[model samples]
Target: MELAKEIAKGAEEEGAEVRIKRVRETLPQELQSRIPLDKVEDIPEVTLEDMKWADGFAIGSPTRYGNIAGALKTFLDTTAVLWKDNLLYGKPVTFFTEASTIHGGHETTILTMSTYAYHFGMVIVPVGYGIPELFQTTTGGGPYGATHLGSKEELDEMERKIARFQGKRIAEVAKKLKS
Candidate 1:
């Protein structure tokens, strides 16, 4: 999604290595194989190995009734091995979500996902109020990380701007923690 890319952009600008992953699609043949999706090599499937290799995380999903998407839930569920190994312990993490409307569970999704981070002993990195966008934004984003509204595949000016703030924040935190 545009918001996801925006967050990555934010981190990349701060010198963080960015990799994008998507949960395995369980959609039907037609829905899953759309033209753009046919290029699967560009966006690799999210794997536990990817989790193991990262210093930090920014997980985003489409809200499903104030909760995370089942696809993402399923992906996370497979990380039992990581949890047991403490593979992600104390790593920084953040989240973002999208919905069709303003109140479409962005906060809840980001907040709820933090429990998973907690389970892994990861540090929760909220976007926080340091960014002016948090105080003045009329669209997505809150104390949680970057957020976006609308069905567009790309972020608008506000969402992109705020996402940059989130990306920089995450990069700073992850950089410090990594050192």
Candidate 2:
């Protein structure tokens, strides 16, 4: 959630309007009750309409077996109507993710998520070694997208910077496309 906020901050800095929404939980109620969700309870649930409303998007998810979390995948799977209408076509989209370890499929999760963007006809905006932080960080950020090591309580400075850069870059590209 913190990573998403940082990305949103970067977008806002780039003069883009941003909305941060969380995918609805897909876990069974019994299982959901065991995890603490209060920190994100107030964030509005993402909807297909929200996808249409945005000029660009930065999607963040936790990696699950080298894939996007089920909640986010489920949300993306519901976008057939939007896909049919080409509502997201030509828009710029980027991704961010978290994994349990340094080798915990962060890049793969981003790659897997990019398939959705391709099918939606959205342009993928990758980090792509454009920033020095990518070279310096031992923790998260990478060419695929901004990421965080899930073992950390908070993002290290480099991770935060990389995420912010991603947000700013996506917003800049979106603005150019809009104009």
Candidate 3:
């Protein structure tokens, strides 16, 4: 959630309209309430209509056993209709992931999620080397996408800058493609 917020903030900072929302959780009812939804303020539940409204997107998730969290994957699975219709084709999209450890499979998570964008025919926007912060970070944020390797409650300065840069880059690409 912190990743998404900062990404959206960065996109808006670059004059792009941004919406921060989450896909419906597929967690079992027994474990659903355990998630502190209020912790990630300002993110609304994402809907298919919302997906259709975006010019670009930054889909993020916490890493789970070297892959995306099940809930997010489940949500992505629900987009088959859009995939079939090619609703997201030509739009720009990027990915981000968070993990508990410094090497906690973040890069793989980003790669796996990129497949979804590929199936949607979306233009991929990588963070690349445009941001000097990427080279200076001891933790998350990479070419695959913006990343986080520590507490979700807070971010290191480097990670924050990378998130901002990734968001800005995504917006810039989306604007170019849109025009």
lDDT of each: 0.83, 0.91, 0.86
Tell me which residue pairs clash in candidate 1. Answer: none
Tell me which of candidates 1 and 3 scores higher on lDDT.
3
Best by TM-score: 2
User: Which digits, one per residue and each the tens of the lDDT, describe model 2 over residues 1-179?
Assistant: 88899999999999999999999999898888865578799999998889889999999898888998889889998999999998999999999999889998998999999999999889999989988988898776789889999889888899889999999999999999999
Per-residue lDDT over 109-167 for candidate 3, one digit per residue giving the tens place of the 0 to 100 score: 99999999878889999998888888888786888888888555688788888998888
- Arranged by TM-score, best first: 2, 3, 1
Cα deviation in Å at residue 86, candidate 3?
1.4
Q: Which sections of candidate 3 miss by over 4 Å?
A: 151-153
Which 10 residues in a row give candidate 1 its minimum summed lDDT?
32-41
User: Which window of ten consecutive residues has the lowest lDDT sum in model 2?
Assistant: 30-39
lDDT of 1: 0.83
Question: Which regions of candidate 2 deviate over 4 angstroms?
Answer: none
